[model samples]
Target chain A: MVPAPLPQQLADLSDLVGRMCTHAAGSLQSATAALLECRERLALQVIAREPELDALRVETEELARDALLFHQPVAGDLRSVVSTLRSAGDIDRMNRLALHVAEAVQRRHPAPTLPPEVRDDFAEMGRVAVALAVKAADVVRSRNVVRAIELDHDDDAMDVLHRRMFEVLMDPHWPHGVATAVDVTLLARYYERFADHAVAVARETVYAVTGEEPDAIPI
Target chain B: MVPAPLPQQLADLSDLVGRMCTHAAGSLQSATAALLECRERLALQVIAREPELDALRVETEELARDALLFHQPVAGDLRSVVSTLRSAGDIDRMNRLALHVAEAVQRRHPAPTLPPEVRDDFAEMGRVAVALAVKAADVVRSRNVVRAIELDHDDDAMDVLHRRMFEVLMDPHWPHGVATAVDVTLLARYYERFADHAVAVARETVYAVTGEEPDAIPI
Candidate 1:
């Protein structure tokens, strides 16, 4: 088969990145829900789906390399190709965060990881994470710098939720046992870091578009 | 100035990567000591040194691209050049982890982050992190696949230490409050991730030499 035109190649690359983001976001949402709701089947499904994200990352990187080597595209074209690689790395980390959530759920099995006291906090964090993931995917698809900047606001909410969870953990009258405290800390971090990666993708997306880091405060 | 020979250029690239690894390892070691010892000055020093590591990564990437474009290296040479880029990413992450450690220490200054009970554990974890960073730098310098594989053992010990720290966190009648628990969890994770990044560098080094992954288990 003949090689596709440069625009077609770029389009294919963009499409692949979008798909990867979709997979990563879906897996993260499902995994977080599994942890909160104790859905073993969904948790297992999330675990099984990790390799797909890994494959997408590899495919995107290879395509980016081939585009660079063959086309030797310069300026914006070069930035787009490089951004594909950088974005793939960010997406892959998001996927890994999703897998960790799944594994946390799997480790706890029938018992829910979040106890009743902190359950609402984790639920809110999960909602924020899912929202960020969805927005991150959109940013990858559209490269809308403004929308990418908006993700920072969403990520801020995640941070607030994370801190609230810590408040409950550190309360003098905290009821949960140490095991539960450990679980909560890890669970909160998973959501917080998931949001952080989304913001990272957005930052890189902005960089790709404007060829400079967006004005969003550095993480 | 005259351009260097192709082999000389490759050697220079390797030398630069080795230096990055050294700086990354040194920064990690200093940061961990500063954290365990509650040395604000050293922590500040670690934080200040971060930009140098970031600059090194950018320089390494530029050199790799220049080598790829100018020399058109192929086969093992090409693999080595590509590995430089990949290894640099891993090393850069290790440096970031160090920065996080320093920042943690700085964040909790005037009072030790680790309480008396878990201080020893954190100290040991810090030692393991430093050892792994040193070994990682050596692997980058020598491209010795055997030594690279050995780094896995160091990582395994880090994992064990992390688990032991969790055991203390989960124990009933734990004395420390929730904030300390949070600090311990974050501290353990920082060390664990630092080790993981070292293993990633080792894996990339092994791949650079053998064109295939070694028998070491994936992180």
Candidate 2:
């Protein structure tokens, strides 16, 4: 059977990327629930699903390579394929970061990785990260440069939350020992990086559609 | 003027990636010095040089795109260009992770980020990361599948160092407290990620040369 047209292939690439982003978001949500509630089963589920996202990334990249090989697409089409290739990597990284969160939950086992004082902060971080991933999926599907650029602002919220986590760790009256502090520090970094990858996906989408850097574009 | 032949252009791409890896290693070396010595000037210098690596990444990618556009390379040539494109990104991230180490130094300014107890551990980590980056640069330049495959084992050293940092942090008698523990955790992550990117560059090199995933290759 003749392969779909280049445009159809490109659209399929976008859909694949969107699915990866959504999957990453779901994994992160589950991982966060595991962290906050001390649920090893949920964390284990998130960990088990990691290879699924890795497979999706490999499939997306193979599709992109084939698109480049067969279509020899130029200009916008070339940009779309290249952008999808890069975005798949970013989305896969988001999944890996979520896996790290899940692994943290497993490492702590019956004990919660997050202290009671900072549970709300981590819950908020997890919420914001999932939102960014979901919005990043929308941006990939829509290629709406406006919404894509808005992801940068959305990531600012994540940065603020990351800083708050640090503040809690640094408080002089803090009771959690160095071990919990290390856990919180690494967990915060994972969520921050997850949001960063989501923003990276949006940036790739913006670049794919406009051939302009997302930062240079007027929001 | 006539453009270089496709083979020549591919060689140029390899050279460009090699330079990026070398530059990244230098930045990490300086950043590590800054972190261990509390040398704000060195940290600032590393910070100032970030745009240089960023520009190099853009130039490498543009060259890769032009090769694809004009030459329309097939098979191995196509893989070479694609692998270089991905490796450029990994090397750029190596530079960014180095910059994070520098920024941590600047944040802690007058006070050294590493406490005396873990100072040697971080210094060792810094050394291992720089060695990995330097070896990765060699791998990019040589495309020696054997040497490229060696980088994974090299990264195992980095992994050991990373775990050691956590051990120091988790020690019961640790006196650095949460604030310093937070700094150490992030700084350790930066070094670990820098080494990971170096290994990723090697994996790309292995794939480019052998058309086989690095892990799948018999080492």
Candidate 3:
């Protein structure tokens, strides 16, 4: 049997990456729901899915390696393979970050990980994070440089939410004790990092298509 | 002009990666000092050096790409170049994590970022982080699987210090307000992640040499 052409393999790699991003988004969404609603089942589901995401990442990377070895692709094709390899790593980290959020919920099961005062803030942060992941999947699937560039601007909302969480945590009137403060701070960081990885996926897509760094491109 | 052979190019790649790890170790040490002493000059120096580290990572990645293109090495040589590319990214992130620590110092300068109670803990954490980076440099330089595997155990000390910071923050008699707690939490995370990147570098070296994941190798 003949091997698939290099372009076909590259396309398959992109499809796998897009699926990984979608899975990551679902994980974050479920983890956030668990955090807000104290749903241990949802949190556990996210945790259980981590191994599957890891397997996907390994598979994507191997496909990339084989393409390089068998096809010895040059120029744009080489860039796409390299970018796919890096983007798989980013998407894998996104799932890991989501798993961290789920673990936070598990640690505080039956008790809300998010405090009442900042529940709305966390809810907003979660929405923004899920949106970024969804957009990242689109960018990976379509290789739309314009949409990829938009992810940077889209990430501003996550940043604002991150800073807002810190402000709420540091308020003089904060009633929650140090333990809760620590949880909130770490949880906020996880969501912020999840968004950052989504942005990184977008940047990798942009570079694969344009041979230019996302920031260097005139938007 | 005669281009260097594949073996020589691979050796140069290893040397470049070793330097990157060493540079990362130095950055963390300087940043830690800045945090401990509230030394704005040291913090500024770390910040200034970020571009140089960034440049080094780019050069390392380009060299890896060029080697793949020109030599088209197979088997272990190909693995070495790919691992070098990944290790350069891990080292780059190590430098970025160190920069975050420096920025934290800069933000809280003239006012110590660490409270008196947790000052010693931060100092110890810094030491462990630097030691891990230095060891990682040696492991990358040598490609000794045994030494690479040892980094995981070395990281246990960092984890202990990280948990210790939280214990201090959560102590009922804790005097510092939420602001200091936030700063300390983020700083601890930065150091922990820096150590994680060091461990990752070691793991990559192990994979390049053994064609096996580090964890799968029986000690």
**How much is A25 displaced in model 1, in angstroms?**
0.5
Please, what are the lDDT tens digits per residue for candidate 3 over residues B1-219? Answer: 465888888998999999999999999999999999999999999999987887777778777877887787777888888888778878988999999999998987888888889889989999999999999999988988899999999999999999988888889888888888888888899999999989989998988998875446664
lDDT of 3 at A160: 94
Candidate 2 at residue B51, lDDT?
86
**Candidate 3 wrongly placed segments (more than 4 Å):** B1-3
**True-vs-predicted CA distance for residue B116, candidate 1, Å:** 2.7
Where model 2 places Cα greater than 4 Å from the true spot, the runs are A214-219, B214-219
Misplaced by over 4 Å in model 1 are: A1-3, A213-219, B1-9, B68-73, B213-219
lDDT of 1 by residue, B41-86 (tens): 9999999998898777777776766676666666567667767776
In model 3, the fraction of reference contacts reproduced equals 0.48
Candidate 2's residue-wise lDDT over A10-127, tens digit each? 9999999999999999999999999999999999999988888878888887888888888888888888888887888788789999999999999989877888999999999999
Lowest lDDT sum, 10 consecutive residues, model 2 chain A, at: A210-219
Instruction: Give the least accurate 10-residue stretch of model 2 chain B, judged by summed lDDT.
Output: B210-219
Query: What's the true lDDT of residue B34 in model 1?
Result: 87
Candidate 2: tens digits of C-alpha lDDT, residues B109-154: 8987789998888899999999999999998998887888888898
